[model samples]
Target: MDQHVKTLAHLFLDGEEDKALHFTEELLNEYSLMSFYEAIITPAMYYIGELWETNQISVADEHLATAICDFVISQIKGKETVRSGNDQSSGRALFFGMEEEQHYIGLKMVSESFKAHGYQVRYLGPNLSLEHSLIQINKFKPEVIGLSAALSYRLPGLKEIIKRFSELEWKPLIMIGGRMARKFALEELEADQVMIVKDLHHLSKWFEEGREGLINETS
Candidate 1:
């Protein structure tokens, strides 16, 4: 990383909100928004989580760190495209959850990662009904759709939702990931892709590979 980015990461790790925000904005001005997300914010978030896990930071501190990180991300404006441009007709995805699954941190990170990789993201907020999900897919017409299932109990509902999508003429590349995805076996969910993301690197690689395959096929 460059000097400015290294400083920004330290500020975030030290929980210095004001300094970090200023640094992030400067980085945004100097680099592509996607670069800031993929290279800066994503990695810093991983560091914060690791710090918390090792008891080096308090829960309150971790929460504050995430809030500050989110604040910086929210301030970012402009094209907001990842490796791709603003062609909604191309490289599209809908990321959301099965009904009753409430955790959103992982989903939010996944959404941001997808956007950073140039995929046009239609992020459906948590607890979306099957009807609402179908509506968004029909409207966006994305190439891929992902559902978050954080709870084991909601797997049946998730399966039904996947089944409905499969039945559609415009069936997307369906994928599932989260705690439930990790705790359970892949054969159980029966998704086209069953993923358990341990960090942003894994998430980034997955999207890049998926997008490359799509491009190759289209080419």
Candidate 2:
């Protein structure tokens, strides 16, 4: 583990919002936005999760850390400009955590990644129901939809959500992500229009290369 990541994790666990924000700002000077997310914030949050899982930290402690991390992410995003030069017409995307899935920090990072790449984004945060999701999908008519789940038990719900999304008339590209995505093969979910993106780096690569045919396939 990087020393800086450890320090940031400490700050998060201690609920030191100002210190965490300042430290992250220093890191931003040294790293690109995506790099800071992938190399630093992601790992620190993972460490926090591990501690919670092992009962080293209380649930309240975990929540405090998560809140601080969320604050830091928002601060970073506020300071940065969207770098994607793509036309907004071809770049609409919507992201949300699955129903009952409350872990949305990763989802936020994914949304920011898309935003940085110039995608017009609607990030609905965590625990959004399917009916509301459908409403937004109909209104926004995104070219892509991103869904996230952290726990394994959310698989059934994830499948149902994907099935409903696949049935949509517009047939937007569907992306599955979060910890479960990294741990599972999810081969059954991959199809002509659905993809499992394990991390932001993979997502970035897709934006650069793999997205050519996929985004326009339904059109």
> How well is each residue in 68-151 modelled by candidate 1, as lDDT tens digits?
666666555333553356545348878987777665656776776566556778888678899988898998888778788877
Query: Could you give candidate 2's per-residue lDDT for residues 1-219 as a string of tens digits?
Result: 999999999999999999999999999889878888999999999999999999999999999999999999887784444444444544789999888888999999988777777778999999999899999999999989999888888788888989999998988889999888999878788887788888888776686675755434422
lDDT (Cα, 0-100) at 119 in candidate 1: 70
Residue 97 CA error for candidate 2 (Å)? Answer: 0.9
lDDT of 2: 0.86
lDDT agreement with native, every candidate: 0.67, 0.86
Please list the residue runs of candidate 1 whose C-alpha ends up more than 4 Å from where it truly belongs after superposition.
1-16, 22-66, 76-89, 190-199, 211-219
Q: Residue pairs in steric clash, candidate 2?
A: none
Candidate with top lDDT is: 2
Best by TM-score: 2
In model 2, how large is the Cα lDDT of residue 126?
A: 91
